[model samples]
Target: MNKSYDLIAVSPHPDDAEIGCGGTLALLSEMGYRIAIVDLTNGEPTPFNDNPQVRIDESLKAANILGIERVTLDLPNRELLDNIEARMKLAKVFRKMRPKIVIGMQGMTPKASPDHYQSQLIFDASVFYSRLSKWEHLFDGMKPWRIHHIFYYYTARELFTQAQPMQFTINISKHFETKKKALLAYESQFRAHPSYNPPIIEWIEGMGRYFGSLVGCAYAEIFYGSTILELNLFKQILG
Candidate 1:
């Protein structure tokens, strides 16, 4: 029997999903939604860390912190590309897991890892490829599954913002601390290590606060989607 998920987040690496949408994931899981994060790579061989298992362990810890499942693929870390192999691997997951919603990382990070941009391309393709009819042989004969909704999360690594057609923020006031704790679980990446020593936690908090202020909340996370969003305007405005 195949496993199922209500939502699956595609991350270029372990910490991306945590940094981008941990609060939202936590809130949704609390609401009894089946959510998971799929890391495209182990995110190893960085300046500070050489051990891949450490990163893997950190990712699992973060997943536990946010009450979500995690899956790490065997793709290359820094050398990730939007090729057939990568697309098929992710599409296969979409087929097997059968998520109704898929959230992916958006934007190109020139200063950061190029894998982010490649991840975006790969994610877009996998969503399409996952629903193809005659790709049974490539995906080990798994049935094609069409995801119902698509959303994009930002890493906040870019210096400038790219205007998206459908952008919105979710109130994460109650779950902001959960998101912070999850990101802190990635000690190898955020802590004062050999080389990577940035005020990531502080930065993330600031970003969350800024976005929250725009929506009159204590904390919030931003997301982009192509699908039209339908909501009760009066309830939102009065709340």
Candidate 2:
């Protein structure tokens, strides 16, 4: 709420954004876009991460790696509910940040985490509610704001067999290493996992390369959007 952001990425937990779209975020940040991440939860109560403060610190580290701001909501993890209250809370953030574009997780997931879908619902509702003038009182005196676009990023654990096709791919080959550094900030979640047989970072990098192959890049991240994106200039689409 300190300053307006050009983009805002909403994450179900502290590390979700880093895992999902860190490379894109880093690229945007490097391009001088004011961006921030809103974490729905501190991502606590895990098998390795019991202390909430540690997770918070790790999230800040990740945000630093991406050179963006990070905000954490006080919603309960693993039991996030997509209700009016949650929508209102996120709407306030939307109004405060006044982002031109908003990004969030794809609601359709065959995974066990209800938090992911709930977070998506909250983001979808909040984007609409933020534009309502009547919600001025609810948003703590902030003016109504409308987001121009919404994009969805994928997480590594999603059941890709039933996943939706990506609308576009961002060539993050230049920023893939930066993304890995940001993800590694979550030591408790990745490095400290009990069954850390397969390195999560390696798998994520491999996935990025695989996605890049589809678009003839070294490494990339995929995104989906319901609305068609209009290109103003041919040069913009070249990159």
Candidate 3:
């Protein structure tokens, strides 16, 4: 049997998870939840870097910093499509890992790579595909296992996107530094990248601060849920 995880985040590239929900992942790990990140692509051939191994090593280092496991799919970067093959590949991982919660990338980024939106579609289809019975052949003989929850983390690239009324913000105030370190691990993309004018790190930190303010925390991340969330009591809202 494949190793099980309590949660899994589907990322379009190596740094996508770190950018979207790294602090939350770090906090969850500290809470003792078994979590992993599945990167759809290696995030290669950028303007500043051409060596794929560098990106791979960086991703592993970031995963280590976050106290989580990392799995990089062989899917093509910059050319990711929401097709059957892509869906099957991810569905296989969902079947094997058997995550109770699957967090995926949300929103479209017209200024960034189109892979983000495609990855979202793939994540959606793969979630459904993972629960289909008698499709063992398609998933390498793995048995059907339904994921109980699904959520979305923003890429921080959508300019005018607004959070839904049911959307929730996770307080990552304690683990905010850990999230910064995890992002710094990808030096090739962040600190060393020349084309980023206003500096990417600052932009990310600004988003964190903005979200944190919403929840009255030092730092937080926003997530969208597929279903309505239930509160046990009125006091739960106080947090």
Candidate 4:
């Protein structure tokens, strides 16, 4: 079944999307938007998680909570690189999904994991490469696809010290609990981590509330745009 998506979020690891934009995803899903998440890595080789399959299972559970499809690539965790090969692999998925909006990681996190930055670069290139018609041979005969919009989500490990101002925010006050439940699906990473501190769910909710406060909402998720977004009417801004 070749399914199309309205939005596709590219995650650096299995749980990155759930941590970064689960609330917005949940709200979008409720609005009847078809959304998918492509995980660049399986997020294995962690201190507590021994079975890679278990992580895949957990990601599926989380995806179900958000009501979106999830795809995991074979890119190695902690060693993601933004190279031609990686970009081509991702381009194939972009062509297949043909999403209108593509969401990815913010590229300027110098203190966070290198995989975060590399994933950003890979997505930036892959989105562009997906529109190149001459890459048919390299991309398994997938047709060219040009996405309309690209946005970046903030990760849990991300520090706000160097945060870029969000261009827009989604009010997820109604779906905030659903986001927490989706994140809790990754018990191996958050619940069982040997050095787990600052309980993850609480922190996620706090951040959501803080961002919501900026927009005068109860809970919200922030996004950084790659280009200026077009507004059709004044009511859109009023909301």
Candidate 5:
């Protein structure tokens, strides 16, 4: 069993983590890579679950669907700030997960909530914090995690299109539906919500198909990276 991971998806909110790399996570999981998804918040300001407890419950249910390690920072919606306390909490998780690759939102917004930017900041901080020697407490016996690569996943496609140097894209057509199913686990955010006037499923599929077309597929997930991408000498290609 290949328990070691090559990549990890980081998100500030419940759905953000899954949406950005759910298909890739699933595909990689099938291929035996250990994948971890971090959910920084409980998806607060949520219109559906009037009670705070219910939203937390829903988030956990959704995490179970993804099938890997997960964490909830429980940060308030639209009020996240970059601070030492918050960074340390995230850093600890990074030390434990110890992934080789990291990806998260670029904090792009049109009519976006503060959560969008906060989420991105968390990813950036975690990526760097994990490598710092100053943070000796995050890991057992001060073992630092040095990630090899980092990428920014576009936050809101309806508003922002990052012209970042494109490294590669995951053709999600084959398992895009699997990703959607995992998303559907967040029933509270969609069906359970009072103002879910527009079901999330429709938007997810629309974006999936839209992006998938970019790489000659029925559905695909896109990612932009700073470092160059290299196909392993023995890499098994995926459709």
Candidate 6:
């Protein structure tokens, strides 16, 4: 039997999850969740961050900093939509990973990038596809995989907020610094340009603190989910 993962973070852009949910991922991984990451794009042809191979290297660096096994689709930089072809390709990943939980990046909708839109499609599709009684080929008959939960992390600042309605607010103060360290691994992206980069890691820490303040912690990782989280008798949200 495949060892089920406790959480999976899906990111459309290179630094997105690192910015948005890095604290959560770090905390979960530390809590012994078999965390996995899927990056849909390779960060190529970017105006300031070009270089395909270089981008992949930097992504791997960031993943290593988080100690995550990242699966990059290596799709085109700014385009990752779904048609028969993209869905079919993603189906292959769903077949292989068999994640028990999935998370995706959120969007402002109609005002998001094609990559973000496609990532959302992939999120919903993969969640459904994993649980189907009959998927279209590539595997044996009646291979069904149901994920226990789905989360969409903030990416589109317009719709999601630094102080938005959150499904679950996890305290990741201990791991916030860890997340910052991992984000710094992607130096070529955030530390590369003159006018582009924000103090990526510090900025994320500040966001964490803001969310943490909402829940009486020094840091928190906000999450939006599809289903009501299962809370144990201890009142901690069950993984």
Candidate 6 residue lDDT tens string, 126-231: 6766666656464454366677777788753445332334477778888877788877777677778746756555667677888899989998877786676555
CA lDDT for candidate 1: 0.90
Q: Write model 5 residue lDDT over 20-117, tens digit each, in one string.
A: 77887777777777777776776776665677667667666665665666667766667876676667677767777777888887756657566677
Give the lDDT of residue 63 in candidate 3.
Answer: 98
Off by over 4 Å in 6: 109-112, 139-142, 159-166, 230-239
Screening candidate 4 with a backbone cut-off below 3 angstroms (N, C-alpha, C), the clashing residue pairs are none
lDDT of 3 at 50: 77
Per-candidate Cα lDDT values, in order, are 0.90, 0.85, 0.89, 0.86, 0.70, 0.71
The candidates, ranked best first by lDDT, are: 1, 3, 4, 2, 6, 5
Off by over 4 Å in 5: 1-5, 137-141, 155-157, 193-195, 230-239
lDDT of 4 by residue, 55-168 (tens): 999999999999988899999898999999889889889999899999997755566568888898999999999999887888778889998788888874554424554468
How many clashing residue pairs, candidate 4?
A: 0
Judging by TM-score, tell me the better candidate of 3 and 5.
Answer: 3
Worst 10 residues of 4 by lDDT: 157-166
Q: What's the TM-score of each model vs. the native? A: 0.95, 0.91, 0.95, 0.92, 0.85, 0.85
Candidate 2 achieves a global lDDT of 0.85
**Which is the better candidate, 4 or 6, if ranked by TM-score?**
4
In model 4, where do residues sit more than 4 Å from their true spots? 160-166, 232-239
lDDT of 3 by residue, 93-193 (tens): 99999999999998788888888889999999999999999899877789998998999998676533546556888999898899999999988888785
Q: Which residue pairs come into collision in candidate 3?
A: none
TM-score of 2: 0.91
Q: Flag the better candidate by lDDT, 2 or 5.
A: 2
